[model samples]
Target: MLDPLRNQSVIFDFIEKEEYFAIHAPRQTGKTTLLHELAHRLNKEGNYISVVFS
Candidate 1:
């Protein structure tokens, strides 16, 4: 099973403010999911452009 920690607004807020941030953890630690959520939030903000890709 994949366990993902949710409600990471603090980290996402930092990124939304045009500040650089990083989330490092072991494999299967929800790194991609966190980034996905962050991107979604930023896009929804309507005041910034958020992009995530390989």
Candidate 2:
């Protein structure tokens, strides 16, 4: 499994800027996993509220 946080530098920038964004990819491409990991990390840091809608 890939480390969902390592290659997502730009996502952090988006979050910092409070920009809205969406993840698009083929099925089974780890989109959900990435979102879950991102939310986990953000919540763990205690600086933001992250929720997964799907």
Candidate 3:
């Protein structure tokens, strides 16, 4: 949504390194939204099979 602009590279870095992290924010602060976007990116890469349990 809203064509995510910032979190892509950051999330990709973490996912690339297989590092674990969490998106923390009060409700409706784009936590789930970002996670879904990140999950989509990871899935489309065709390199890492991923899931987001938001």
- How badly does each model clash, as a count of residue pairs? 0, 0, 0
Query: Which portions of model 3 miss their true places by more than 4 Å?
Result: 1-3
List, residue by residue over 1-54, the lDDT tens digit for candidate 2: 545566467688889998987777778878888888888888999999888884
lDDT of 1 at 1: 24
Native-to-model Cα distance after best TM-score fit, residue 27 in candidate 2, in Å: 0.5
Quote each prediction's TM-score.
0.69, 0.78, 0.71
**lDDT against the true structure, each candidate:** 0.70, 0.80, 0.70
> For residue 53, what is the lDDT in candidate 2?
89
Worst 10 residues of 1 by lDDT: 1-10
Model 3 lDDT per residue over 1-54, tens place: 333566667767877798987666567667677778777867797887778763
Q: Look at candidate 1 and give me any clashing residue pairs.
A: none
**Pairs clashing within candidate 2:** none
Q: How close is candidate 3 to the true structure, as a TM-score?
A: 0.71
RMSD of each: 3.0, 2.3, 2.9
